[model samples]
Target: MQTSLNHYSQNNEIHKDIPGRKEIIGYGLGDFGYVLIWTLVASFLTYFYTDVAGIAAGAVGTLMLFVRLWDGVSDIGMGILVDRTNSKHGKARPYLIWMPIPLAITTVFLFTVPDVGMTGKITYAAITYSLFILLYTAVSIPFKTLLGMMTQEQHTRSMIGIVGAFFIQSSALLVNMITEPMASGIGGQLGWVMTGTLFGVLAVVTLYITFRTTKERVGFVPTAKQEEKVKLSSGVKALFKNKYWMIITLFCISYYTLLGFVGAELYFAKYILGNASYFSIISLVKAVPGILAIFFMAPIVKKIGKRNMVLIGILSIILSTFIKYLDPTSLNYFLIGSAFNGFGKGIFGAMLYALINDTVEYGEWKSKVRTGGLVNSAASFGMKVGTGLGTAIVGWLLAFGGYVGNLSQQSDTALQMILYLNIHIPFLIAIIMFLLMWLYKLDKIYPQIVEELQRRKNE
Candidate 1:
């Protein structure tokens, strides 16, 4: 028989209440709220810093480095803080209520490049960027932790991943579609600020619905002797040593980096595609599979196994990316290649969190310690680091290319470098990521881990 099947275990010890379907959907919006601002930043912020705001690319990149560095350190602290929390709504959910205001303020101002001289501009960028990272930490830690309590069953967790992925990708599509054309018509600063504000408000409603309606069920229960002494440091240390977790951390870093690396297409869509409307068209093509993937993605994982699905995705990305590299000027080749890339990304993105939930269970099974907050935060920290690094590299490379936006005249070499940065880098990174993931051992081994956990519960 399947030794890892928890299909028969009693619900009480594992969890209290089954999270409602409504709660699952609503909580998704909250998670999406965090990502909406992030998507906006990713889609337009580099263009904003160098083009509209008139900031130097090198300096903007430096500011990003500091912000992500802060993000990395804060994740450790937030993980600890979550462990110490003891609210009625549960440990991780409380921060959802506390984080929205700071996120809104910092994000709005981050877009507002002041008329400071070079010195003032640098100072403005530094302060705003730092605040953005801190607030992002404050919001995202709580938001990611919600997945821990959403479902105890493996299948149920996978379903949540599907829903959440749809929202995140859909938002990304909208951001990519709007950023340039809107900027062209309304101009830069207002275009980004208005878009950010509108999306931020929408995200707030989603998060609030999640907060007011969601329930926490699967929390760590401390034993009598250990009840009072469960400190954050303990959780942090336990998370670091986890083997399954080690694989996950590496996976997230690679996966997020791969995605950001693809973001170079924003520039390609802007300049080489010959118009901003092509961005929306390409994004729509990309998003269609993303929409459909959510419904079938979970079942695909169940049938093929998670590791195999990841392998398939990695291969698809590699092939599509390389194809784009080989035939850069043909729209037919590019469109087909991009569709495959998007389809593969859609599959993987919708499913990575499901893999994370499995890792959390594996960690609990092997280590006899629970650290959901630590688990989520560490992964998120890796994502933020990747995002910051990706954007910074884009900015720095643009500076190197000497590509000046809205120029009455353009240099041939500078334009060429911009195209190269837009297309070539993402293609190369996606290839490297495929090879790295080929080394992943966790998903194939997870069924064995699941069997062990069920046996312990059954016995």
Candidate 2:
């Protein structure tokens, strides 16, 4: 049972805090649009660089590493900016409206290869990809920050996160299903350009819906005297002091690094499995199980808490990673392993943002400062850093394994390297994530934190 729409404020003050069907659907669509373009970059961009755009593997790896690292650092700056912003649309929601058009434009530019020589190619990629990531930070940090403002109830936030995750994975699955064949059938760079354009258009529309439907209801409003004293720097210092935020940030890094390995899975499907179409099958197996898992988690999450659910998911990931090795050549084993992996990722996708939002209350309770943007932004920084590192590592490893693009057959070393990425590395990451989740005891004390914050608000 959850509480009603009327929520409490300072001195037992009451306000209507509404996050109903419209809000949930609008919120989910935001991520659904985000992942449409995000999946294109995460799963296929590296492949596009090496195979279609004619960049060397090492160059692509180095390029992604630097750009993504900078992108992560930029998130902190964006967070700070978001905290300071005041508008009719509220702090975070305005960004949902302001940034998506440029974001959509950059999405197309990322897949477009300029007709130039090798050096020129690398330079072009660097510029466009950097712009893409920066714009992503601009929109994404603000969108995530809105989660805390929409409502104070943990269960409602979790439900929003769950619906958002469903859309995230569903969009990823859609991209995987269509991207290769669509690009292949259309032929040449034109194919990718058209696909990127379609996703970019969709991104602009869905995010606008989010901006229109959601409202900021739970942000902390300071007294006149307190407002004069509050500094952004102090809020940042508070975030670092937050032990729970640190733990979850690390967890994000590990989880996304595991996602980075996904780039190599295409190579595995192509050379090792000897079937390009297996990539689609693999995507199907992975996504369907994860999507299904999301439906069942809400009830369990309500009872046992998000931390426990994540622990269970990590264990599933670990088991799935090992299962792939049982008979590496068997497609059945890969499909089964993918099923387990997707289920775990589904749980993670549903819960990670909600958990980050929880830390906002924790931070305010501990440090007496509420930083919705900074908190979400810093955590998002960890995610992008992990994504950058993961994607870069894939490029580095593939190069080390003597991989070449558009080859009829890759070397035995390349095959071995791909296998290690798909199986060994992810297993180790799952173990690391599991340990981090074990350290998270926040769910047990979150109520006390909330109660205390409310009591303080009465002062």
Using TM-score as the measure, which candidate wins?
A: 2
List where candidate 2 sits over 4 angstroms from the true fold.
1-16, 220-222
Candidate 1, which ten residues in sequence have the lowest lDDT sum? 1-10
How well does candidate 1 score on lDDT at residue 389?
76
lDDT of 2 by residue, 1-459 (tens): 123212233343222455877788799999999889988899999999998898999889989889989998899999988888878888899998899999999999998988799999999999999999999999999999998888777777778888888899999999998999999899999999999999999999999999998988876355653465348779878998999999999999999888887888888888888888799999999999889987777788888999999999999999998899998888899999999998999989889999999999999888988888899999998998899889888889889989899898998888888898899989999999999999999999987787787677676
Clash-forming residue pairs, model 1: 4-450, 4-451
Candidate lDDT values, in order:
0.70, 0.87
Report the lDDT tens digits of candidate 1 across residue range 29-87. 77577767887776667767776788877787777766876888888678767866887
RMSD of 2: 2.4
